[model samples]
Target: MTYFNKDIETLPIDKLRKLQNERLQHQVQMIYNTVPFYKQQFDERGLKPSDIRTVHDLHKLPFTKKDALRENYPFGLFTVPVSDTVRLHCSSGTTGKPIVVGYTKKDIDIFSEVIARSLTAAGCQKGMKMQNAYGYGLFTGGLGLHYGAEKLEMTVIPISGGGTEKQIMLLQDFQSEAICCTPSYALTIAEMIEKKGIDLKSLNLKYAVLGAEPWTESVRAEVEAKLGVTATNIYGLSEIIGPGVSQEDFEEKGTGSYVWEDHFYPEIVDKDTGEPVPEGQTGVLVFTTLTKEAMPMMRYWTNDIASLYYDKSAKRTHVKMGPILGRSDEMLIIRGVNLFHTQVEAVLEHSTDFSSNYQLVVKREGTMDSVEVNIEINPELYKGLLKETSLEDVLQHEKIQQAHKMLTKKIKDEIGLSMKVNLASPGIIPRSEGGKLSRILDLRSK
Candidate 1:
């Protein structure tokens, strides 16, 4: 219920549109005058800053994609000199070149403010102790959450990420009430608590804001039950000012995440067509930075798949984005069928018997392609089975076999692919050490 900036968050839609229009216009002019990237893109199209007078004219501009960032390298897209940029962050791209982004002091403040708003929405309160597990340095997760938590007036335990043993020790010792980390890492910690037989009363955590990877309702359910907290999603990217572009409200779980539109105006566009889509239709997300001073983005293609709509019954006035279905540019093509891992994740979400943790392994066999899904068995069920039988014999159990068959059939039926589903013993798959977990392994190239 508490808002870091209630005035902007609850601005009337009409007035919000006017503000967005003004900011978008200013951002266009600023970028066109200073950055070669924007100037070149606009000039090539015979466009001028004055041509884009409002958010409605945003479609007239070309999209700034990750390739543009890569082509610009360290500082080409920057509107100001390097000295004016206060801090920098880079994404660990799949290729050799990393996508770098910079922020000015004001940009940093904007980042903190949006994250402050995000934390408040995720059920965090002032004076509450926050154990920030998001990693720091070059990567924006740790410091991003740290500054925001401080702005929110909570006691911040800047523990960073990893050190499973130390994280647990400090959580019990300090009794931090909220945690921030990747969903996979959170699950690893939850599993560790049970496997180590740690006392539940020792932990005082109540809220978790998980992101940097696409997760499902099943993961949320697991984290909530295991950690005894209300887990919500906080979404962002290195290019879009880190983990506060939008956030899911603690009370409104599946409704969507409210985008901080005053700063980041959002539009959903058809991935292939590169045109805006109708409201509620799934497409690639595009954002035009309205207030970023360091490196303002113009219709930056986010690649994230989701639709946006105005949630009439919400605490904020900003448009809400549905849970990211998957990445548009990264969707896998297997045997002529395109799929996102999250689609398979949805199957796991519907099944209460399986663990949310899983990985996709893609391989090519003599002119043919195949997919194998390795999913972790529920820790509680595994632990229970160990009491009666050995780990090897547990797989022979009828319930375990049935669950595996059901999951495989579900994936086939829903995703339209016959993926080989393997139910692994809990803790068999590798977990996130500190950063984002790579969920897919494509061996076709090899």
Candidate 2:
């Protein structure tokens, strides 16, 4: 299938910038004229729509934050009339208040196109059958990929998440070509595939578009090895437009996600200063939807820290954003050192004995902060270690010490912090009853 707007997707760098500038100018005027929130914000800043002539001038526009959407509640920054809004979705708000987003029919169409483009970039073809395991309903993952799969004329099995047994059954019976879901769920499914002893070669599955949660290369390798599929990352936020912001092409290794700039203008800026960061430097990711009709933000701070670089190989002039490092709020300050959950996960992943199911607990001990990594070791390995030697207790204790030493060194290297590590049995580590992993258990006092 060919893109409806090929020029924008394949435009040269200079031409793409010109198109973005033109769209930015028009959207600024449109929002200023119709949206009360933009009007008030611009009026307070003493800025006119004419001031935003180029995409670089977007720095002058106020940045929209999650609190702004919460303060507005519903339908606050919508550019089009409420009557024109055809659909709406709200964020899960795992962190804070849920932000509601409205979408006109045009906006929905653009969203579908962007998602389809992302699928195509990941090498999804028309004749292939896909099993969409992303959750539906209030969450955007399911419906976003569902619509895009249909748009691509791929026969879709709308298997909305959960029910691992049924999902695997259909995956095998239907000979599915691709699956779309979060990286965590993908790993879970892969584990199930191994437990069932299913021959992945017999099934038709080839590719997977995994997102919704930040994942590391180690996890991707695990998923690919287990499922026998090429894994690609798909990025989006409900605040912007779900599942279509950017996507990774399988041809590249550790390359940034190629932004769908036709509908959204992407930028990276200094998190503290709100000034544009130099290319290839990590900073806050910001986006402005140029063609969104219902709600088009001028500059929305995504809180995700990543770098952006122009992909010379793609020749599309679209900025590719690096993998999200971690959330700004999720960063922990321990003894004046910055720590992230991913750092802990990376260290744990490097150890074969460490189970993927683990949690990081950051708590205060008197005058200083302390970190404890509670990890679960695979049951088989634990049992084998116990049976094979009289040094079971010694081995376990030494393993914890080894993990602590390795983690301490890695953390010191990454963020200059040394932390304590603790080990537990396979199921000893606390997780959600439903088997969901918890990243943090912060007990810092206010």
Candidate 3:
């Protein structure tokens, strides 16, 4: 019911479009005048600043990919002088040169403003305490949420992810009401709470805001039930703005996340043809920053596959985006069946006999690619089985065998592909200490 910025958030459609067009045109002029990359891009297509009069004219622009940022390197894409920008954060450069993002004081403030809107939507309130478990430093999760919480008037823990012991201690001591972290890490914490035999009632956790990786309803239900909180999804990419480009309302969990359109204008385009798709059709999500002062991107392709539509019965006026199924680059084709690991993870969530800890192992058998799913048996289930039989029964146990068969069938039924399933002991699969866990092991490279 509450919004961080109500006036802009609920702005009428016509006025909102007018604002977006004005900002888009200004952004075009600013980038064309300053950044050489955009200058040449415009020149190549003979795109004058006057040509882009509205968001509808966005199709005239070429898409900016992650590689473009890499090709530009550190400061090449920046539209302002070094002295004008206040700070810089960068990707790990794992692929090659790091994609560095600079922020002016105004840019940082806008980042906080949008995140404030996000936290509020995720059931955060003024004076409520939040344990921010996202990483700090160059990574935008920690500090982005931190400043945004401050802006929203909430107390932030600034734990910076990991250290299960300390995180548990402060949750009790601070009586925090909300937590922000990756969904996988939230599951790890839930498992730790079970292993530690902590009293869930003693803690005062009310909400879990999760993102940075694609997750499913199964994960959401598990985290919410285990952590005793309502879990909502928050989406973002570092290129456009760090976390808070959109947020799922706590009340509207499964529906979709509302894109704060006053700042970020969104459009879905066919991945192959690079043409705009009809509304409600799944395609690559693209963004054009409307009011970014330091670095405004035009038609920056996010590569995330999801449909967008206006929810007429929703609380806000902004268009909403469905949960990201998977990134374009992460889609794996095994035996010509296109699938994402999350699709498999969704099936696992339907069964209680399995924990969220699982891995996808991909290998090439001769000329065909094969995927093997290795999921850990729930510790609770394992403990129950131990009381009834010996370790040898794991192979022959009817219930254990049934659960494994059900999981394999679910993958085949839901994901449209048959993957080899290996049910391992509780601790067999690795867990996330703090950061994002690599779920897919592509051994085909070797």
Candidate 4:
């Protein structure tokens, strides 16, 4: 219900650092003693476990990248022996080779505590029946939340994902109070609920912990309106022990997720320079898993870009990371202009009164690069405008022009990118056959 470990969760700044230092020291020793990969890294750097004393000393260690995890494959990074490993989870790398992570029983318990804290921060309580719709299997989202909910004594319905009928049926019959899944899935489920004429008010759902993909505030509002539940963004990666690294405490507005700094240390650095950026400035998120048992990462580059704000009201110094602005690797340069997919999505979020389902198509026309946005407007909204004897068809084109102009200016101001935009009819944009949404399609011959 409340803090799982109240002492640690609310530990004073000085005490928390002390705890972190101890954990960091222990983790370093464990890695040096057991994990060959870390042993080699430390040896190459001429460093010893004792070299890392305070949490700030983490910088002395080399940053871990996704490639390192991939290169290690299944178990090269394990600080503990495989015999002590209790669980294994692999990322759903739709792009290439999947990154695998192993967790000991102690590691799993720590992860559960972190997720439990996330649920509590989002106001989930004991005895509340929660429907966890996040994908389970090798992906850590579903199971991470599943164990956390159970640890918090909340009754959990492990509905995996992608069955709209079953999800609604359980929401009705079980009177589930919360749902956890990707933001896109939440919207898709809301669309299904409306299509099926389900009474959202009758369902006892109160909160939705949505993440796994970048989503806009407009989508959050849409989900809340359709499902009649307060929505919160929960962020994490399989590399950092999923779903509990950071979470938006809705009580604090859109102040971003409050990073659980006790378990994992957080930092923001200039993407190019790799130096620490100012607190309010946007930069790529880097993390160090200070207390993980199976795999402890030191200065792992997360690639996510956002600004970090320290929230003092919570008494626990929580790191508030802005909405994942975009991925560092997803940045595109067109005619000496740099831009990201989230910037395009931000423009769409403000200018479109349509369904949030959309796509960004980037292609090279001759030697010039062009960007086009394909969006779908709701028929009902269009009908309302058409009733005023205003030709909705013509107005749609005007809206497109307006969106294009606003987006072009915004992109130019934000990232110095000049782009072209286009709009498409509702349901025209492609959806992932596997039920997930792909945000970008770069047709540029790389």
Cα lDDT of all candidates, in order? 0.89, 0.80, 0.89, 0.80
In model 2, state the lDDT of residue 38. 87
Ranked candidates, highest TM-score first = 3, 1, 2, 4
Residue range 162-222, candidate 1, lDDT tens digits: 9988998888999989999999999889888877888778899999999998888878988
RMSD to the hidden true structure, all candidates: 1.5, 2.7, 1.1, 2.8
The deviation in Å at residue 273 for candidate 4 is: 2.0
Poorest lDDT segment (10 consecutive residues) of candidate 3: 90-99
Write the residue-wise lDDT of candidate 3 on 1-446 in tens digits: 78878898888889999998998889999999999999999999988999999999999999999888988888888898878998788864477788888888989999999999999999999999999999999988888999999999998899998999899888888888999999989988988887888889989999999998889999998998889999999999888888999999999889899999988999999989999898899999999998787778889999899999999888888999998988888789998998888888878776788888899999999998899999988888888988888886865679989988888888888888988998888988888777777789899998
Q: List model 4 lDDT by residue over 4-99, tens digit each.
A: 567766677787788888878887888889888889989999999899898888777778889998898888888877889999999888877798
- Model 1 ranges off by over 4 Å: 350-352, 386-390
Q: Best-fitting candidate, measured by TM-score?
A: 3
The weakest ten consecutive residues by lDDT in model 2 span: 429-438
**Model 2, 211-316: lDDT tens per residue?**
8877778777777888888999999999888888998877774787889887788888887898998899988889998888788887899998889998787635
Better of 2 and 3 by TM-score: 3
TM-score of each: 0.96, 0.92, 0.98, 0.91
Q: Evaluate model 2: give its TM-score.
A: 0.92
Models sorted by lDDT, best on top: 3, 1, 4, 2
